[model samples]
Structure formats: C-alpha cells, structure tokens
Target: MSRQLLQEPVQDLLDALTKSEGPDILSTFTTSPKPLAHEHGLPQLAPFLGRSFHGQEGISAYFDLLSTYLQIENMKFEPEETWVIDESCMAIALRGTATFTWKETQHSWEETFAYRIKVAEDVSDDSEKNGSLKVCEYQIWADTGAAYLASLGNLDDMPE
Candidate 1:
C-alpha cells in the first residue's frame, strides 16, 4: 500500500462520523476488533462524562451518550495539514466546525482536531474477507467547558 492509499479509509470514516451514522462508522473497523479510544479533556466537575471507550460496544455506548446531551446539526472538516507516516499510519491536523444543539441551545464550535489513524494489517488486500482500515485512536482538543455549559442550559455562563 502506498502512502496515498492510506488517506481514503480515514476520510471515509470521518465522513461516516460527521453524518452521525453509527452503523456505517462501525463498518470500518478491523475484523479482530480493537477499541476505538476517545479521550475528552473535561473539568473535574463532569465525572459522568467518559474519558475513554473500548471496543465497538463501548464506542456505540459513547455515541449514545453523546446523542442524549446534544444533536449535531452539521459537521465539516478541513484538513489543514496531513502526514502519511507510513503505509499503515497517518496523522492529520484538521480544522472543523460543528453546529449542534445542546440542552435546546444551538451553538457552533470551530476548533482544530488532531487524529492519528492506523490501518489494519490486511488492508492492503482488496478482497472482501480482508479487514478494513479503522481509526485505532482519536483525540479531540476543544473547548469542553462551553459544551458542558451548553448541555446544562447554562449558556449565560459560557465564555464568549
């Protein structure tokens, strides 16, 4: 697999996620199944908020929790920079905007997100039985305080 080939699967996964389609997103994972780790940097006050999720089931649960607190009206990603570290690894510096409704308060968040994705070992094979490339790790560096406030209907206290 060439470096250029690595970008397709990552882009496909991002597209599925931006659409908020759980099933479609899950189809991109490897056959042996690895955890899709999501880490959120939140204040100590939000203990119920999860900092990590494991496997497909955990990933599903995480998405379910997110849906309960907010509805993503729109999500767009602009890759300002991307590095193909290898045939199976890639990193992207993406700037994106998300318009969502939290606690009935609509808000738009524009931030830069970093992603490190790894393709499955068998991804080089185009056979149907072969596994697909998936995101093994994802990290979001965003203003969680504003999100938390919005979720609690405390928009008045949110930073400008």
Candidate 2:
C-alpha cells in the first residue's frame, strides 16, 4: 500500500521523467535535438528523422518547443496531494491512461489532453475542460482526464 510499491511498473520511468522540471526537460532535449529519448535511453529517433512518424517523439518535440516559446518559469509535481498508492506492495503499475489531441486553430494550435485521474473525490466528470479541471498554457494544455490527476494540487503560476 506504499507509493513505491504502487509505482513499481512506471515507477522508475515516470519518476525519472517527473523528477526533471519542465524547463529542465526542455533544456536537455532542445539543445541536443536527439538524446536519451526513450525510457531506455535509446537513440532510435535519428534514423526516422526525415521520415514521418506519429509517436512520442513528435509530441515530446512539440512540448519542448512549446515550453521554449512559453518561456516556462517553473515545473514541479503536486507536493501536498495524496498519491493513489496501491493496496499491496507487490501490485501492478499504479497509473492510469491518457489521450491527447491537437488541432490547428486560426493562428495557433488548440491542444487538449484528456485523462482519467484517480483523485480522492469522484471527479470523473470534473476532469472535463468545462468542469473543475484547471487548465494551463493559454488554455492550450487543457487536460480533462489522467492529465488532471497528474497535474493535481500543483500551485505554480501559468508557464509563461
């Protein structure tokens, strides 16, 4: 029932990722163009560079660029919130799923990532954009599902 036990599956991966602030995350990748991108630190993206691919690389790249453009000030995990620890130490990945979609608006992109956050309250409906989900980044990063859970309880100013 501990945090470590619950994070067993994506514990190391997500932990390593989340530990780095968004600005730090941007610096590491933006300057390099290609670095330890995957969970295993693989350089497989170079070969597929000129080619077209729709995966984490593109999305991560977009985030990096967006972070740079926004001049993000700070990035930190929700400190005071309660993490959904598992009932047992030897349980599966105590994480949920998320989906993101973006569309080209008049002058910029309108992006939204829907999530199924596991909060203390029954907020399945509150995760929607119109609900209690706190949006970020000129409302471009408006998340409605697990993203809300991932970003829960964090009180940093908008990244701008």
Top model number, lDDT: 1
Per TM-score, the best of the predicted structures is: 1
- Tens digits of lDDT, candidate 2, 42-123: 2232221222222336535645533433222222233213333334332222222222221111112223322111111112
What is candidate 1's lDDT per residue for 1-160, written digit by digit as tens? 6555666666777777776544486666543445465646763524325477666676667677677766675677766244535653444334556765674566444444455566554443447736655565555555576677666667666557
Question: What C-alpha lDDT do the candidate models reach, one value each?
Answer: 0.59, 0.27
Q: Give the TM-score of candidate 2.
A: 0.26
- The list of candidate 1 runs beyond 4 A from truth reads 20-23, 43-50, 79-89, 104-112, 122-131
List TM-scores for all candidates, in order: 0.72, 0.26
Candidate 2 local lDDT, residue 19: 54
